[model samples]
Target: MRLGKTYRKGGFMNEKVKSGSRNVAIVGPYLSGKTTLLESLLFVTGAISRKGSVKDSNTVGDSAAESRDRHMSVEVSAASTEYNGIRFTFIDCPGSVEFAQETYNALMGVDAAIVVCEPIRERVLTLAPLFKFLDDWEIPHLVFVNKMDRANIHVLETLHALKAVSSRPLVAHQYPIMQGEQLTGFIDMVSEQAYQYHPGAPADPIPFPESLKEEEHIARAEMLEALANFDDHLLEELLEDIEPPQEEILKDLKMELGADLVVPVFFGVAEQDYGVRPLLEALLREAPEPEATAQRRLKNIKGDTALAQVLKTFYTPQGGKLSLVRVWRGKLTDGIVLNGIRTGGIYRLMGQQQQFVNEVDAGEIVALSRLEGIKTGDTISTEQQAAIKLPKAAQLEPVYALAITPEKRNDEVKLSAAITKLLEEDCSLAWEQHGDTHEVILWGQGEIHLQVTLDRLRRKYNLPMTTHLPQVPYKETIRKTVASVHGRYKHQSGGHGQFGDVFLDIKPLPRGTGFNFNETIVGGVVPKQYIPGVEMGVREFLTHGPLGFPMVDLAVTLTNGSYHNVDSSEQAFKQAARLAMQTGIPQAEPTLLEPILRVEVTTPSEFTSKVLQLLSGRRGQILGYEGRNDWQGWDNVSAYLPQAEMQNFIVELRSLTLGVGSFHWEYDHLQEVPEKLAERVIHSNGNGGNGNSK
Candidate 1:
């Protein structure tokens, strides 16, 4: 169906922007002031009249109720503005490692990214994972060392720390001027021009201070040296002590940056809007255009057909489904149906507010409403049969889990549907119907990540949820063999009496050899039909043994039995077998067994020893550790850990490694729980009825 039509009357259809547009994502560690940077960018660009603070929850970014309540961004927030005759769409991404998936997905659609970070050297390790992602994808990025005014250490030391986490060489773009522990001004490294800061106005140029001339010379030479590595001509000039032209240095910076060969470092204090103008000018001059990004990612977006990629998905009470899509090629207009799903309305998003638009050109980021079947990372084209494949963000593995149930029993079905929508909105969320414990386990990156999802459930779906630590799937087995246990069931209360008798032999099997059943009868002592009933009874009793867990690695054989011709029945025989287990299992030396999981923990090499110590403290058996195959400067430690100890492993691991550590685990084998802990667990299970006794 043809869907081209005029949108709402007098909308942004008449407000045409320049063809030069770029999409940039602001990302860093949590509490690095990404939202504040967005506010400064918007205010300086005339997109917003007044700047809002994160404390007051009035910022355009972090507009979601969950984010505002927590005062942290939960997802990517998009805003558009024009600066220096160039259009830009800046996506503010959540810096919390728990929400890094949001930033990762948005990064795929942006031309470049501003890696906003604080000047605290101790917290610099938090940037490792994000930096690795950008480098792995070959995305051009710059580091904005924020909170420069509050820096307690030298700027060079901060740069040194940042360089440790990044794979690309870093070039200093500006040098901060400090006067008695306060930021006074900055020197542009390339032009050697000095500027003094003025609150709420452009920084005015001034003469280069003689006190910093020597230091500035050293920094500029180092910057030039880093640039020279990529250009032989520049190297020759540097080697011969011939000063390179300012224009040549700028060109090298632009070329190397756009090519993802080097990362240029800029200093700023976003709260005071310092260095924003210079940052904006650098972006305008150096950051790659959208076409360059598209060419690097998508090879065949040259066709006339409309092509776009879904970068994120959102659900609102008023608007059903909003798919945030980046138009890669061709035009996206109202009522367009791409790849079988029809788009209802098109909008230009400013934080949470939507401005209706009739048409938007390529290289623009916009929201398409009611794309029901569309999902994040999907490539859509207007051609009905066109199948185009585009790059997708890496899927994040969930490290933390919680068992959740609806607070209202009647809302069970509603909870399932709500969870579906929630997962649609945040792809990092996952859920499982645990087969052994029968718990509905919800998984995510961390505690806060799952907490935000629960809050969203309550706020958006009106479904209140209660969560608990997931129960471990534990099994039990007999330590010794017992034979010739007799069980008889007789009842004579009605016209037909029930009478059955059976003799069974129980024996221990090898570990990991699951349950087995067998029978041997002679001279028709036990009828074939009733014999099956006896086996079923034994199986049912084994499901919840004397220790209150499923029995494993054991075999039961019906050695001898008797049944009356008239009174014998399958139900009677089954009950007789169960009675035999109830009487014999306690005497068979039954013991509790807990599940052990094979865990693979990955962290920076510096934290490998800490991780090993952590595992040892938790009674985990260290199998080995080695450098991760695909990740540089990271180690993967393998261990066997009790499932019970893993409940808080992710939380503690993040605490130890600044939230960059993670692990993957699965059930490996069953081991006997320690006597002391087992006793406590048994008592707790008995009181809480968590023993899984049917």
Candidate 2:
């Protein structure tokens, strides 16, 4: 009853079956007992002793500092287990939308998934994003209705709600046969057996539910009917009024589930461990095997065919970057160079420790050492086999940006190195210098992501950083063209008098034409030697126009100018040109231009109105909406919004739809920021200089 070891307990003494390899992803809504379920699985398989709880901070996974503090999974953690001769690599992915990208990454390279859902209808809404990810990838996945004893909703209604969000048919393979307020046990419709947990211990076994026979028969028949739809022979046998054999039904189930045609739902109370045994057996019997998947998706490289793909990446304190991968094909032996790339040490990971294993065969999740070049989605192929690309990992666009710099001027080199290492681990983050603002900016999935990278920089890399809101690379341009303006500068300090004059016209060029300068003074009133100086001065002033932002989309024409015999130096001419730029530019009535973005959002149709309201609140224009047939009750909505308004759209979009809707945006065009916002931005950027410069 104490989650006893498998072989020692008086459970079913099943024969040792030759179970193959399978990849299982444990995903669920926030605090829906996903980590607890994974811990229980580890315990039942003898991978660990007595499941560790999040409150205790001793769970097999959820070891990150943030995860422990929040008492929730913040990162995806994977571990392999062998139960009943089947090898399954289980990934416990985070449920929070703040870390939903991490959950999406875990879904890749997995054969099937166990989506944990809470019983409360609103509480269960958190699982919508996971369902959306499953839909996008078309990955075979099942739903596990967790917290049965504490759940307020009925099991049948919960299943119906779950089915409403799924594109594929969601059939119940297990149902609860409750006794009063207590869930006495569950009926495994697939196996046609009822299991009653030991009443005294709640985890101990007892006699099956006695009164659910008639109900179990109907549920079992329906489950079989669902399976029969996938197999022609099974359908024929069912039509002939014959009950299909257990073996045949299981085969059909595995085939249909692997093909992602149907998703089977099951009820469970993970806290009491009431429904774990049947789920374990179901995984062993019906979950897809690595060989079947490998055979279906193998490629021949040079010679040896190796089936492998990186599922996750961990930056360890001692071992550095450890790329966790599941080997699906040929054997990987020590000192054996499979491919010319990264011919080095092969390691196995157990939590934070890396165990040196001599060799790892197919179905093993091992970590490779010094894999500096290996990335999260890289396929580790053998020399003989052609590399087969795994399903693409999610590419998250960075939403929040911050200007990062070394706290100390001298630590710039170290800061650069730290940023590079951070980027290597998280390819989703982007960094570049804003050429217009001359400020370096770092971009990440959200504000927390950037903050975490900064934390890691100080903690792991010893690089203290300074953070500030990134400078917007604003531009200034004219609304209308202006004719020429004659300007001159004459000054006498004593030794030499400065005297120069120029005739200039500022005209509007096509958008994005940049700044262009021309000289039409054929008579050489302004000498050719000083002509270059005038152009130089105009170009320099364009960097910070009257509005203190870059000036563009304008043409400066030097039609005529006067020169002094002795004091008419290039410097004087340049000053004359700078004066000309100040006088002629104002006539154009330049306005500040801000960056606009084209945004695309995807959300369930039920939340369409909410998403529209969010867009409208952000001053976004709704372009159009298109619904994909494959995405159940979801529509892809596109819109155009100002980039400044999209700083936190990722977070807002998630919050608007109960952390279900998502969006992507990129720079589209430039629009004039209102005078109020432009003034605020200019003041914040230290642009409080004189109104006119000459």
Give the number of the best model, judged by TM-score. 1
TM-score of 1: 0.95
Residue-level lDDT of model 2, residues 1-694, one tens digit each, is 2222233222332243444566788998888889888887777778886778889988877876656766877678777777766766788888766566677766766778998887788876666667767867667888888888777876666776777677677777777878765766766564455566663232333466667666666666767777777778988988899867755765677778877778888777776666666677667666666665555445443344766777677786776777777777778777655445554567754444455878877866777766666677777676534455666666777777888888888888676667777766666778987776666789887776676667777778777788776655678898887777877889999988998899998887777778888989977798989988899888888988877788988899999989988889888888898988888888888988877788888887888988888888887889988894566578999898877676667778877787777777778877778888777766765554322110
**TM-score against truth, every candidate:** 0.95, 0.89
lDDT for model 1 comes to 0.87
CA lDDT of each prediction against the hidden true structure = 0.87, 0.73
Name the lDDT of candidate 2. 0.73
**Mind giving the per-residue lDDT tens digits that candidate 1 earns over 236-315?**
99889898887688779988999899999988889998888788877877888887777787775456788899999999
